[model samples]
Target: MAGWIWRTAIGLAAIIAAGVASAQTFPAKAVHIFVPYPPGGGVDVLTRTLADVVSKNWGQSIVVENRPGAGGVIASQAIATAAPDGYTLIMVASGHATNPFLYPKLPYDTFTDFSPISLLASSPNVLLVRSDSPFKTVADIITAAKTKPGGLSYGHAGNGTSTHLAGALLNSLARIDLNAIPYKGGAPAINDLLGGQIPMSFNNGPESVGQLQAGTVRALAVTTATRAPFLPNVPSMSETVPDYDTEVWWGLLGPGGMPADLVAKISGDFVAALNTDAVKERLGKLGAIPIGSAPAAFVAKIRADYDKWEPIIKAAGMKAE
Candidate 1:
């Protein structure tokens, strides 16, 4: 009996060592990073950049799958249900932090169901108007909205998107009512803005950086605590309304149960990738700042945002419409 027990112990030890060795050889196959927004959006762009560099460095291919709907619910749910293998991951936007409050019941728990890898970058939303519009600045929009409630409108990806929340926060802060118009995604909303269907919209910096430069759209203010590096001339919305700020930050995450060593590998590699000169230059052109923040910091930001917005969203009477 003693000899049999020793043999079983030795076999178990061998299996444990094998598991550790396999984990060390991470990304032995093609890895897929799920992007919750549609193609051409900021989150999509960030993920594609990281995947390009990381795959090249590891000598393996990385695929990015776009799943857009329900303010990212479809994609979030898919990632949540996927196997905890490190092969499947996601690059989430600010919507990930806000969805828990905006949606009454998400298909998955944002914190408990996922492991945060790192915050890749953050893109602030800028309030914009058509180039030839009479409104010279953000105050003009506020005054116009106040004078004619629901007369002024803004657009977003959907009901619970960061764009939608930015508009809501603006309304709450400025004490005005600028009705929100929902679109399937930012690309369409931006399309309508350029077509003059919507007067003004709070869109990400990269989405409008080109149009702004082309003189197609005129920017009034950005929704960051400070002016965006891309739009140095554009003032922050908070400059007019105290304590008012909004943005669409993005980060990488994975399905729960990733081993500590594997998680370290992913977080370290991506952070290093973000700092590469090529990656930095590309991000700068898009008007985005590459952060490559820590996993704990990312998790903490999500939790803090979840707590802060629950009451605010509830008061705004927002739903997934």
Candidate 2:
């Protein structure tokens, strides 16, 4: 009996030691990052940039795979089913938090099926109108909508997206009934807005910054609680509707059951990459603020955001289309 007990204890200790060694020597091979959006979008750009920085520091190849479809469900499903090792990861956006309320059934659990690594960055969604539009300010749009409930229409990247939710929040907080028009993506929505096909759109910073800088589209307000530094002149929606605030964020996640030590290492490394000068400059130019929070903090943020948006999405009857 004593011999049997000793052997079992030795085996258990060996397993734990092996896990610690594996975490210390993580990234034995190239790492693959799955991006839910296509290349050149804000998420893709941020993922690739971080990949480059982290790869250089770790001396390992980091690859980004674009799997854009079904509002990021495709990539998310892939990541949730991947091995819990630190090699496979996904770059998730704010849509991840609200997806549960939007879709009746998901292949994997949003909280249990994945491990939160770190929040990469966040950016404010801008409320924009064509330069030639008659509505000059947020008050003008609100007043117009009050005059004709559900008469004025606004476009968004898609239903249940952060952009869409921003517009919906506007309707709720401002007590207006502006009809929401969904587009396949932000680019198409911006195009239609430019063509006057839609009166206004809630676009992310990367989508609207170039046009806003060129004076092609007029930004009435940002969705964050405070004004976005990139557009200091524009007021925040909170200013008009007290306490109204919404912002889109991107983060990293791995499959559930990842070793805690491995999770900490990855989070620390990614956060370090985000703090680099070159990466900071690029993110600033992209109108994003880098936030490299701890894994637990990131998980808490996801839960908090999910709670905040679930009721809004449910009330609006938003669903995956």
Candidate 3:
């Protein structure tokens, strides 16, 4: 019995020591970050920006792969099934929390199959129209919609995306009936908005910033309760529709069962990158505010957001189609 106990203790110590050593030298090879959206969206841009900085610091190449489809489900499932090693990760947006409610069955559990690393940043979705459009303010759109029920149409990235939910929330809160037009992604929706195919669109900051800055598109209101600093002149939707608030956020996650120590190390590194002046400025230009919450806090946020949006999603009858 004494000999057996001694052997078990030694084996456990070796295992722990190996984990520590591995974490200390993590990312000896390239790290791949799977992005659910196609390249050039807010999530993709943020992930690439952080990857560039983090890769430099870690002395390892960080590759961002775009796996856009089914409203982020493709990349999410891929990450959920990836090895628990820290090399593989996924950059998720606000859609991650609401996907469970949108789809009847997911290939992997949102909370169980992945470990939350950090809540990187957030930005408001803006209600934009072409500069030549007749609508000048949030009231114009609502009044027009109220006057003609489903006549006025707005496009979003996809059903159940933050942009979609923002439009739905506006419809519900303001008692309007603007028809929602779903597109494959934000880019196409913006294209239609610019081409006069759609009168308006709920676009993320990164998607609309260039147009807004170039005087091609007009931002009537942002979805958040407060005006986005990047678009200070634009009003918040809440100013017209009471209590209205919707913002998209991004975060990093790895497959579940990653060593706690490694999780901490990665979270710390990413958080550090987010706090740097250069990163903050770059994200600011894109209308994203750096968050960088602790891993536990990020986990709590995912749970809270999931709970908060489930009823909204169900009430809206949102689904992946």
TM-scores for every predicted model: 0.91, 0.97, 0.93
Q: Could you tell me which 10 consecutive residues in candidate 3 have the lowest summed lDDT?
A: 14-23
How far residue 87's Cα lies from its native spot in candidate 2, in Å, is: 0.7
Whole-model Cα lDDT of every candidate shown, in order: 0.85, 0.92, 0.92
Clashing residue pairs in candidate 3 (N, C-alpha, C atoms within 3 angstroms): none
In candidate 2, where is summed lDDT lowest over 10 consecutive residues? 14-23
How many clashing pairs in candidate 2?
0
lDDT of 3 by residue, 15-41 (tens): 788778778999799999999877787
Q: Residue-wise lDDT of candidate 2 within 141-241, one digit each (tens)?
A: 99999999989999999999999999889988889998999998899999999998989999999888899888899999999999998889999998889
Model 1 lDDT vs. the true structure? 0.85
Report backbone clashes per prediction.
0, 0, 0
Q: Which residue pairs in candidate 1 collide? A: none
Q: After superposition, how far is residue 125 of candidate 2 from its true place, in Å?
A: 0.2
In terms of lDDT, which candidate is strongest?
2
Candidate 1: worst-modelled 10 consecutive residues by lDDT: 15-24
